[model samples]
Target: MSSKQPDTGRLTEPCEGYLVTPPLLEAASFADRLDHALTVLPVAAVRLRLAETSPETMKRTILDIREIMDRHDAALMLDGFPELVRQTGCDGAHVEAEDVAAARKILGDDFQLGAACGFSRDLAMLAGEKGADYVAFGPFGAEPETEGLALLTWWREMMELPVVAAYSPASEMADLPLPEMLHTLAATADFLALGVTQDGHSFDALWQTPEKFLPLFAETAKD
Candidate 1:
């Protein structure tokens, strides 16, 4: 891995969070949840990952979140729906690492294309080489703080493209608190990707519920 640092000549922004919506969504309700999340964290982007839906439904979901995304100035992204990216006027699409090349071709050069590499460096390299704007690393299981954190650190040293520290929908495990992962990867990742909510609790509880953590995240937002 290369030890060279990234080139940031201007005032560098701190690592930003990215929210991934639930696989199944009721546009309006999910939008409300998403709006609440944006208020808590310094989100830079939001991804809509659908399970199986018609084009119209997908478009509506995008339309609902569009307002909040625009309000927060966060880029809007679709998961595995490169074609809809332009159709819905989203900022980008996140595809399997192997599909980066083909997706890039379809979307052309202007739109952002992120790769879902699921903890594989080789896959990440493949996607990055194929013109992916960024690569996401994990929805890690137990022991993520050690294994996952180590991976993000290694990736920061090795790549210049932004890296996202991703979490699975059931991300808030007892031993795995969001803040610990966020705090540990603050210097390494460009975005922290996770579901909008966990169980019945809102996303804010993951970071915002704790009053003490607010100051730390607020400081990051100012940067």
Candidate 2:
């Protein structure tokens, strides 16, 4: 909650949204690749992995991402550790359902803590009760593609927590080709949780979708 720090959290009411490019262990070169995408997108934040190869190696990757965020004025989101969240100066931490209470206790009131709520309204409510800054609603229950839209709608109405809808391309590849997917995705909720598969992580691939979708998203958002 350092007001002095730039607000790099995801762009949502309860939480800020970022286009998180997950960390890659083998692809040390991927940082720049991901950074390039963040540069083009109107991303509020970026989520980078906390590779646990070794303490020293982890530190190096964290530093690299921090430098990228610093240059972009973007916030960093970590799934590695709460300690790393504080140490790396990331804006927030995303924790699984079982870990939410513990993470909340660890992060305290200052940090942004987002939780995975599955597809249950009770789960989302529990996350809110435990002080989650926002709640993500997938990678489970209904499939992450077409069925996910219904789940997001459910979460939005049933739970007060800000919602994120996550989708893996393999599971949702058919939907990706449809312009309505982008339009409905942008219109549906506060944040869109797109998965970065082996192929989709590329700048050409990722940007291709957005280049087509942003204009469509703008038109849809107006209507």
Candidate 3:
């Protein structure tokens, strides 16, 4: 190895955390992806974005996936769809800054609650203090429209709470492989919501599998 230390960026851990994605496809395709995922990786958890697809269809898909895959830990994220989340009987729900209190009240303490806080450290901290199970930030990539790396760095430096950053596969400039991305995430965020965008749309694409997360696991295991 070179005398120089890897740029761990002040992060220290074996790099294992939750991986979440949306199954916004036909029920058959979604079930196939979930089966493949359970077989491949140590999936810490599975998340479904309810609002991306038709609510009725998504509910059916979520239940079916849960029934078919017995190994993977399952959680549901309701992005601006509280009623649907409640009705689906999900393990938990994800809410925006505005809906945190209400979601917490409804979902109660036992349920996992995740909040989205664009680039605000204060919001992230607040989410933690308000009893959020986790906090999410960027769809971290080369989109100038999205929060840049600096914001994520600031949040990491200031907060003790687990931070989740979204990974955008569509960004033209995000050339770093999954291992490199996981290294960066270890240094900055606690969990990563690898956003698999194929046509400039969220969740309207094929779900990338655990093979995608292998580089990250390998890199983190290194000396």
Candidate 4:
């Protein structure tokens, strides 16, 4: 692991959180839940990922959540929808590694463009070179990859672009607390992009009660 510290210039605090939309975001009720989450948690960004739906439906879904995100001052990043970013009034777009350059052209310099690089350093570097605002590293899954951590450590130590340590829990680890998982990731990642899908876990509980997990972020900063 790299000894150098991750950059905190863009964040209000030393460590910050980012939220990933649940798979089923088209539901009207989910927007309310998202509003509650953002209202309570210190989240800087929200990646809106939706299942395949009609263009009209997608726009409506984004519009519903956009208001809440805007009120909270959280950047709403549309997943794989660079073209619709401006039309939908989104803050930015998150694209795959292969589409970084195209997305950048579509979004221009002012918008926040992020890239999902998976575990490839070459792709991550390429995204950065192509003017990505940040690079996301992994799903990391139940068995976290040493290489993924190394990549995050290296990116944090060397790059100015932010790094999001993403986690999508495997079936075996669904029972673990979200905060507990976040605590482990906070050691190396500047931002945590957590999937809101843990079994028996409530998003309300995670955000409303900061005492349970927010301190873990503060603790990581000290290290």
Candidate 5:
């Protein structure tokens, strides 16, 4: 692995927060809830993971959510639709590891292109070399793998390409408090990709008060 960090440098906070949309959400209703949730939390971005729907419906959903994201200055990244990014006026797209180069080409140099790299550092580096804006690392879940955490630490120390530490909390841990879950994740990642909805707890309910989790973002800068 290349030890040279990129010119971009590390963020002051240990991790920045990002949200993953529920696998299925009604765009119109979800937009209102999303808008309200964002108004309170300081999320860096949101990945729209709408279910496979008609192209027109998908476009409309993206448009509706895009408007709210725009207002809050949070990036709206299409889950796996690089082709629809420009048409829907989205900030960027998140593509599978093998499709990183294609997505980058389609979105060009301006849009944010992210790669889902799982636990493969080789794949992560490959995506970065291919012009990915960021690389996502694994389904770390509640019981994170030691190797995964080590890799994340190494990447943070060696690379400036941002990483989103993806997690799919185990179903058994569904009732765990969101703040607690987030704190556990912050230890190993700079951004958290939460796709699983724990017991139908809305983001609003999980992050009901800023005081509960905002301090995690206010710690002294990491060396």
Candidate 6:
């Protein structure tokens, strides 16, 4: 290593909230939740996810959510569906670290591209190198855990690329309305992705936006 500390940058924007839609995609219901969320939360983007849904429902859902997203000026990112990004009117695609290069080729340079490098520094680095617009590091959908916090701190200090502190349940910290762990993340990350919601912490049960996490963004603004 060089004697001189190499200059590395971190996310300048105070961490903004990011939404990952629940597994089910029902156009009308989700649109309402999303609109409500946009009005209240400082959401930087929304990741559309489909666990089980028909093709018709998928298209309609995408169109419905797209309208709300455009109105809010929040990006509509399709999770793990680079192929459908343009066809479905999505603003971008968030894929696994391994898919970063291929997804970039598919989406090209204009659209936003994010990679989920859950708990793996090596994967995060590879994703950044492969043209991911932003690399997300965390426990993804896992239960509440604290291991991910250390990873976020490391990335913030050592990397110039944008980092997202993926959300976890609020069981770790005590006597706090919102998860104290989440508030700690605001200092370092660029975006905070909503994960499994704990009781008294949920934004909308159907949407899983995490109401308590709103305070950080509510108090501050993001560019």
Quote each prediction's TM-score: 0.80, 0.74, 0.72, 0.81, 0.82, 0.81
Pick out the ten consecutive residues of candidate 6 with the lowest summed lDDT.
1-10
Top lDDT model: 4
User: How well does candidate 3 match the true structure in TM-score terms?
Assistant: 0.72
Cα displacement (angstroms), candidate 5, residue 14, comes to 3.9
Q: What's the candidate order when arranged by decreasing lDDT?
A: 4, 5, 6, 1, 2, 3
Per-residue CA lDDT of model 2 for 145-207, tens digit only, reads 656678776666555466765533443244345445544555656666553543434223453
The alpha-carbon deviation from the true structure for residue 42 of candidate 1, after best TM-score superposition, in angstroms, is 0.5
- Who is ahead in TM-score, 1 or 3? 1
**Model 1, 1-223: lDDT tens per residue?**
1112466531143566677776755477666667766776667788777757777887887777777777776788888889988888899899999999999999999899999898788899999999998989886433446766777777776668778877544444443344454555555676666554435233444443433333435545533
* Window of ten residues with lowest summed lDDT in model 1: 1-10
lDDT of each: 0.69, 0.59, 0.57, 0.72, 0.71, 0.71
Candidate achieving the largest TM-score: 5
Which segments of candidate 3 are over 4 A away from where they belong? 1-10, 23-26, 51-56, 74-80, 84-87, 143-147, 171-182, 198-209, 219-223
Candidate 6 lDDT, tens digit per residue, 1-223? 0011225343444667787766645667566777877777777788877755777777777887787877886888888778778788788899999999999999898778999898999999999999987888874333344567777778877777778777655443333465455667766677777734543233353254445556777545533
Better of 2 and 5 by TM-score: 5
lDDT of 3 by residue, 141-171 (tens): 5334324567776665555555677666563
Model 3: which residue pairs collide?
Answer: none
Residue range 73-180, candidate 4, lDDT tens digits: 578888898988999998889999789999999999878898999999999999999988888988776565778878887777778778888866644342336534
Native-to-model Cα distance after best TM-score fit, residue 205 in candidate 4, in Å: 8.3
Regions of model 4 farther than 4 Å from truth = 1-13, 25-27, 172-181, 196-212, 219-223
Count the clashes in each prediction: 0, 5, 0, 0, 0, 1
